[model samples]
Target: MKPRLAETPVLLGWAEAPLSPWSRFGDDEWLLDIRTAGRRADQNRISWAVELPEGAVISRTAWRGLHQAAKQFLWSMTTNPPTGRQRLSPSSVHNKSSALKTMIRWMALDGLETFSSIDAGAVERLRAWLLVRPGYKAKSITANTVVNYMIVLKDLYRQRAKLDDAPLADPLPHETTYEAAGLTPATRGSIPFIPDAIAISLLNTALQWVEEHGQTIVRAETIRREAWALGLTRGARRQCSYHARKALRRANLIGPAGEALLGAYAVRHAANHLVEACYIVIAGFVGMRVSEILSMETGAVDYHPIGETGVAQAYLVARLFKTVDQHGGRVERWIAPEPVVKAVELLEQLSASLREASGRRELFLVKNTQYGEIVPVTQMHIGWRVNDFARHVGVPMHEGKPWAFSSHQFRKTFARFIARRDRSQLFGLAEHFKHASVAMTARGYVGSDFDLRQLIDHESRAETATALDRILLSDRLAGRMGERIVVGNARFRGRAGEQVRRDYIEFVLTETDLRIHACDYGWCVFQAETSRCGGEEGPSEAGRSPSVCLSCANLVIEPRHAPYWRDRRDRNSDLLSRANTMTAAVLTEAIEQCDTVLNRVGEHDEQV
Candidate 1:
């Protein structure tokens, strides 16, 4: 009898195929490629295929079909790529798998078997069930999470539709159907920038410790100092360090006197905590993602000339995983300021031994023990180191808890600082942050509550007050001039003048602080929207003429205005001298008005 062929599924075997030079494989050739891909994909499917939670069981028929679909999905996700389409990252694959598992579990619970049994009603029921169900963390399942599940189901159907032998009866609900299912949109919160004092306090505590124990054999102390310096100076802390320090401190390995005991007992283990602290500075100051910062290789920093300037600028070449294309490749040249360069250099020096032993080019690795077992610093480790530092330094409390420092917060704080310093350079900020547009930079980094209105109001009031004071102190106008002012049919003097002055002073002192501006013929108590003067509407163009302001009811004659009136009178007098009988009448009328203005100013001066 012939030897039994391995019972490997076509999709699983395909996923295991080596991805290379056969860029133009046809459908038949691709099927053959799957055969050549080997059994790793089969093994992977076996491992993750039917991982159900305790007490969860499905019908044998349902399991067979569901398992086949899942295997195909996982295999295709890894191996098959549509031309020009980017392959999913490992994290993306994991997330999709998790969603599928949840759906399968729901299918078992509902007693539904096979894709044909899943309809819109089944999906809706699943959504309702998820809404009431509690997550592993015991919190109510969120609508956003439900939306994700719906997306996975939709993708599962989409993949089935592409296959020659699909298992589904009808296509799943449209993408829009999932969207209209009442999922709450996610809201991004504002950036939280720590106060300078708090940052300084944390740094000072770390520095003080480092200074007190100069050049010690305790690896923890050395790592702690390096981490603290990085966090405080470069704003580079790892996500792991945020909460990692708490566990270390609880272990009596990361407190004020923990260093001494740590030195004697677990020096090697303590080294990890110190390494975490160093991450804080790099993340916080450099404003790079935790993944990018951690993935930095040895000698990532290099000096390059900045434009035509003789000064050499430091640049850090690092992989940017978040914004990578389909190929999972992202490289960015970040401008490294002095502090960042220094911090990176120090990190290199500290991790030198560990890097050599591990034969890894990554900048951040720690020795596990005396035997020199090396491991890459993880996000969890960084969290512990940061919290430990914060706790030791007595960082200010918020909501009865010490302020939790995380890598995300560090990036936000960095953005906030840059935006606060200069809002006009938002484009430059966008470039530095690698944001797609200035709008995103503004929305994410800049606060909406900037106080520009108050500043403008204050400046306007000051300018008005200065103009008013100049007119009040002029030689032409003297004491109590507001009382003597007169216009067309209105006269303001004595009690009226005193009232006007009183109103002016009160207005200036009040919160509104209304001010006078030069209007058509005279001054007007107009301040954008705060004008108090009332007058009949005049011709639009003439209404704002300086000549019209002269006869307005709001006009106030003073000694300072005498020269202005005199000039008008002299011009009118000259016109009157050579005027014909018809024009002489108009000239006389104009001269008389000028004389009247001059008389008001002279009389006001006499009263003083």
Candidate 2:
């Protein structure tokens, strides 16, 4: 450790003058930029603020050791991490500090006063205690949670030379880190996706508030904020009651049916609900991390059109806080649909007055300021508002209580919603979630939410199972897979009679190496060996498109898909009418393929 005066401790970060990575900060609190600080920003709150633990929370000897270890650990992380290791992310530093604090408190419980007391087998004792530690869950804390506390204990030992009252020796000289905590490879937590009906109700109602009443709520809130700012609400007597009632005649806070939805221009309480609605619309649809959405400024939403595709996708531009593993705070954008765009636009209009007055442009701001300072609302505050919004709209109760709403649940729920209906889900969700595997879902949630892909994959397989069952049961199916399923059912008809197809489907699904990729165009009974699109590698994303499935031997065109093929044929014919020679040839071939399927299903004369 670098020698320093007692008055200028290392935890304050480089004392008076700043050093590399060590910013000018204090012992009590340190605020680091989310852009450069890696995962430091926990929520959409401003730059991450890691506060010092109070000394009285644990024994004085343990507190000194922790404070010393934290100072050296943070200094090493910020200035010089161990060789071959990059600096720890600010959030990582925050977590270690948090874990160590918990360690000291737990040590205090054991009547241990100092880190040096945790020598040799005492580490194992701590691990045993943690294994049975109570949490918010019914069972003892998962081994995964135990890992957080165990790693910090290792840190205190490894850096003993530079720390005061540090551990006497390494805690895990013989055991692996996970071994020390009993964290098995499979000991992980996976959050559940929201139920489908509730998800629909929540999103539809939220969007309704944004699209229908958003503008009025914003306008009305602006008026009220301005009025109160100008000290207009100081009357004790009902001096303006007569004039206020007359002014109510000009109020325009009416719903589509012209009902007084805002109650005579009252919008202060409405603004609270409107903010939560905006949160729901943006977070629910785009699946943005709470930090990213809350970090949005007034002009964050923009139109980004790819002229080549003729698709104008709305984008929410912001500093991505989770990119610190490669780079910190990357300026990126998520593909925001129309509803998301509208929600952000409404927030801009609603917060216009506050942004100008407070001079901070955070979209989610505390309505009332204390001591003339503006404050950004935290994620927990948003949760409370969402509960109120749910009650106001009569969202269904679960187990006799309103369903709990959370930031991650929004992303997970969005995943399942898209998984069921959107074939282009992977690309969109990857872009939105920041997940490299499925979509953009990972960027911020890499530490925990990457496992969410398991849930979506689960949803996909269930959907495929259902589609496969439907196709096998269809007597009038067409295409290669359709013909094969029909013939197989016929071959078993003599043995199983009317239930032959059902038995056949059950056998194939359970016994055979069958894979199905169902889409709006049709189903593709995919085989890696014969697949032209996937080409023996596995299921390629391109295999789901209509063009790729058209000529593939794996294609399965059920009778139900006749209307889709007919509509597609008509649209392509219209394009062919004005196409150049080369394009016209391609269109002609596509039309011929559609005609072949139409003939096979005897849909050439079907109304569709």
Candidate 3:
């Protein structure tokens, strides 16, 4: 008789073709013969294939490495593009070239060797050798770069072992650096930052100087140099002041109002210095990041809602590219202070003259030139320029000063001042800054003893206890647990339960997570002779030597089970409403049944 075809088994309630049994090998090698019909050979053709090749395996690793290398190259290009006396944006070309360079380097190091030929020693030696090379130590290579190389190496080895199921054992060693620990005492708070008071004074002086000089033309370079030294610092001229003004103008802080604010200085010093002063005030007062400030459009700030009478405030809300990266993927919020508002008003006034000269309405702010022309400038351009100007200024340069006044100093200063005012408002400040965590704000940007103090207090046990008392005195908790049954459990019995209750009460009163008392039985009280008597048998001990707590605990208090069954209680009213609504349609039918039963009862009484 002819052999019968095998029946397929059901999988997940559906029939499927039977899978061929796999053969196991002793040496850990998997060899399989896979076949399928092909159209290339004939009308009913079959394709036969053998083992997967090493090249195919290695190619996957190479491709992964190439992808990472390409991204790193793009990042590097964006960060430090090769601009050889060019006026064009070569970002795309530069990224391509950079990717090629990285790929070549990776191929030379990792791809030349076969998977079986490489070992842990090879990887170690490669890193050691790279470290010794010229310029390798100049700047620590980014972790991303090393990761790319390893990805390629891993792919190569994974294929070489001719194994598809197992993972490759390759450990890439990373070089330890100050940034890795997330905190390095030497640099933890050592950022070059400027103090608010000094910044305020600088803004005031610059405004005074600009006001004294009326509409006279002055060189942009001269104005920038003076503003950098007098308003910010010698070191912040190019790095902080230059960018600060540029950002101020971009943020609508240095236009017509800004110019009018420094009205008298229109002629003596360049009008641009007024613009620079406007930037300083906004940067010093608003506490916005340079990038956010730079990326701002004209309408990003609104003053109409306050009816123009509320304490001078500009609502600063904008999306910034740089701050987002630093803040661990979060947007930033800046609440412009009084001085910042005044500064923005001053800038709005100046922008009139700027627009008249440029004959443009869309381009709100621009770099002021000696020729009275406005030149376009981005945050990065102004940042480097300000740094250069700061060096020329006589402002003292000190390492680790919170306000060396980088473009970031404005944000830092704002955070510091608010922390000092009301420490409990940290969450608000964190929300304003668009930071993922207060820790991030504290670590990378914030610099002030007051901020640390406020942070410590916010997280303090004593402070939490006091706050909890205020919350408990209110009726919030009573409303939350209206009719729900609550259960408590613990692995330990008797004495353990009592100790836990005491400890829990202490902790709840002193901690942050909201909780109410769940039980009153003390482990000591239950353990000390209570169990010896029948009372100790506990409600839960129905089947065992020691009953579950439910079996004996007389402490069970069901509020609803109380005789005071006032369904009208404020807490129970909500439940009553829900029940009433659901039974409303069935009410007529229930009433009719009751009337029929009453009539039948009356008829039976008459017969008796």
The lDDT leader among the candidates is 2
Clashes of 3: 66
Model 2 per-residue lDDT tens digits across residues 450-478: 44455555555666677766765556667
Whole-structure CA lDDT of model 2: 0.64
Candidate 3 regions off by >4 Å? Answer: 1-170, 173-192, 195-269, 304-313, 320-333, 349-376, 388-393, 399-405, 421-608
- Give the per-residue lDDT of model 3 (tens digit) for 284-383: 5455555445544445566434366464435655544431232222344455544455555555555654555676542226645565555444554455
Model 2, 323: alpha-carbon shift in Å?
A: 2.0
lDDT, candidate 1, at 267: 42
Greater-TM-score candidate between 2 and 3: 2
Q: How much lDDT does candidate 1 score?
A: 0.52
Query: TM-scores, in order shown?
Result: 0.52, 0.65, 0.37
Model 3 / residue 340 / CA error / Å: 1.7
lDDT, residue 394, model 1: 74
lDDT of 1 by residue, 384-410 (tens): 577876875577776676786765666
Candidate 1's C-alpha runs over 4 A off are 1-46, 49-57, 75-85, 132-136, 164-182, 186-273, 326-328, 367-372, 422-608
Error of 2 at 110 (Å): 2.6
